[model samples]
Target: MSAVGPAEALILLVIWVVPAVVLFFLIYWAVRLAIRHEGRRVPSLHERVTAEREAQRREWAEREARRNTEAPDEL
Candidate 1:
């Protein structure tokens, strides 16, 4: 049987080690986040929409005010 040469050994190391390290970190982060966000309450859809609409309204109001101030008044 042919023994693993240097190049084949490096390829084998890469194929095994990279994903194993990646998978370890993936699970680590998943658990960390799961613990971190365990009991946080997410905003409801209605609340999110209401906040977004209010922000949009304020932005539009500011934009309109700026426009009105910047434009020369028609005689």
Candidate 2:
């Protein structure tokens, strides 16, 4: 068989490279979108922990107040 010409080689390169590049970008964007969506769906661990601590503090304060009122004579 005769050797392939430059134009034919360039055309073949374009056909292969274009689709591969497109596919790469498509997958990249899909993963990024999934991560961003999941971030919005769930609360962060730090926020959850802070909220739990605040709740515990409020509970402790209420218990202390109740105890003080019940035993006003003690120092």
Candidate 3:
């Protein structure tokens, strides 16, 4: 067989290197996503805080509504 020419080497490099990089990134991202999921517990701190704040707001609104209804209006 003849020695491989520069053109042939370039074509082979492109054929293999491009797909290898694409597959590397796909697996990398998949592993990252899996790892991120493994660390979670139910109601993460941020979620718990948000839920608590929302509950407080709801309770305050309910209390205001009850107070307004019970207290007579004074002109």
lDDT of the candidates, in the order given = 0.93, 0.93, 0.92
Off by over 4 Å in 2: 1-3, 42-75
Model 3 Cα lDDT, one tens digit per residue, 1-75: 899999999998889988899999999999999888887747779989999999999999999999989996899
lDDT per residue for candidate 2 within 1-75, as digits (tens), equals 999999999998899988899999999999999999987887789989999999999999999999989988756
lDDT value for model 1: 0.93
Backbone collisions counted per model: 0, 0, 0
- Which number leads on TM-score? 2
Candidate 2, residue 72: how far the Cα is off, in Å: 30
Q: After superposition, which runs of candidate 1 have C-alpha atoms over 4 Å from their true positions?
A: 39-75
Candidate 3 lDDT for residue 69:
95
TM-score rank order: 2, 1, 3
lDDT of 1 by residue, 1-75 (tens): 999999999999899998899999999999989988865869789989999999999999999999989995799
- Output the lDDT of residue 59, model 1: 100
lDDT for residue 23 in candidate 1, whole number 0-100:
99
RMSD of each: 8.9, 7.9, 5.9
Q: What's the lDDT of the predicted structure labeled candidate 2?
A: 0.93
